[model samples]
Structure formats: structure tokens, C-alpha cells
Target: MALAYFVLGDADRGRANLRDYYLAIGPDHADQIARSAGTHTVALKETIESFAAIGADELILLPGLDDVNEVDRLAEAVL
Candidate 1:
């Protein structure tokens, strides 16, 4: 599974988005899936590094909120 609803600096926003996502999808394994999301920059970076260590060829990051600035924020944090 890919990391979804990630916020570069705002952990609270990321978590809120995850909650909303869970409510919308109503998945049976919401708790498990929540672990896949990155709630802050450190968590996101760790997730990326872990994937790389496992020889992952690509990783997808889904935005936590509808903000175009998120792109720049991610770039600033991870790029």
C-alpha cells in the first residue's frame, strides 16, 4: 500500500485527513491502514527511506488536504 494523506510539517492536519479518509472509505482495517500514512516530515522521510531500503522502485504520496502549496512543502521537506 502507498502512503496517503501526508502533510510535510503539520502532523495534526495529516491525522485529521486520515480520519476523514477512514470515515469516507470505512475500511475494515482502518487502524492498519492509518499506519501507512505519514503525519509529519520525519515520519514521511522515514517511510521513504524504509521503502528504499526494501528496494522499492517507486513510492506514491497522496495529499492530506486540498492545498496546492502542499507540493512545495513536500519538496522542501523531502526533495
Candidate 2:
């Protein structure tokens, strides 16, 4: 969505794109996430793996990060 804003120069479209994919985390899902947070280091690793498995391209994830190196790493893939 951020990429949409950047490329199209349309804030509304970017917001619309974001809204299209937005999932409202209800009580049950939130509770499950909270329960999962109580575990050790591997919990985070597993969660990230699951997220990765859900399939997002580099461009979609780029604008959300703060690291220049990671941005550089994924930028080429987007291009």
C-alpha cells in the first residue's frame, strides 16, 4: 500500500489497498496471539516463519522497515 502511494502518488489508493488487506483481530485471535507471546525465543521465530509463509513480496514489506540494509536487500527484488 505504501508502494502504491509512492508509485501512483495517490494517498487514497494506498489507504484503499491497506484497507483491502486489513484483518480485524477480534478477541479470540488476539487472545491466541497473547497466549503465544508467553513462550521462549523460538515462538517469535515460528511466528515470523508463519508470516513469511503467508506470501508478501519485497515491495509490500519495504516501507514498513527502518533498516537501510534490509531496504537495499529487498529493493532490487521489487524493481
Candidate 3:
């Protein structure tokens, strides 16, 4: 499975959430899962491109929180 976190400007928020998620899931594969998150627009875009390069048919962006600004942030960065 693939997972990501896209934040407007507060990368720390995303990292913190990722950390919580990591802890909740246990630390056995933390290294791999931690690297899978994208905390900002540029990183998100890069991740999308990287996946596309590898022939990904679709991409899904899951929210880390309930903030609506994330939609605008993502559009500004990727759309």
C-alpha cells in the first residue's frame, strides 16, 4: 500500500502525524514507512512523478487531518 501526507506550509504537522502513525503501527518497519510520507507540496509532486515514472496508473492523496486548506494547497502545488 501507498501513503502520503500533504501539508500547506507546516511540515512539522505532517511529520508529527507520521510519527504518531508510526508509533501506532509499532516500530518494526518504521524506517520504510517513515520514508513513504511527503510532508510538503514539492515532495508530494516529486512522489507523484516518481510513481508515474514507474507506471503508476493512479494516485491517491489521503489527508492527515481535517483541514480543508490542504485541497487548495494540493491544487496550487500539483494542479
Highest TM-score against the true fold, candidate? 3
TM-scores, one per candidate: 0.69, 0.30, 0.72
For candidate 2, give the lDDT of residue 37.
31
Assess each prediction's global lDDT (C-alpha) against the native.
0.69, 0.35, 0.69
Q: Name the runs in model 3 displaced over 4 angstroms.
A: 28-35
lDDT of 1 by residue, 8-60 (tens): 54656665666666866665555446556676678778889888888786888
Cα RMSD for candidate 2? 11.7
Per residue, candidate 2 scores C-alpha lDDT tens digits across 9-45 of: 2324433433343436555554333333312234334
Pairs that collide in candidate 2 are: none
The residue ranges of model 1 lying beyond 4 angstroms of the native Cα positions read 1-4, 24-28
Each model's Cα RMSD: 2.8, 11.7, 2.5
Pairs that collide, model 3: none
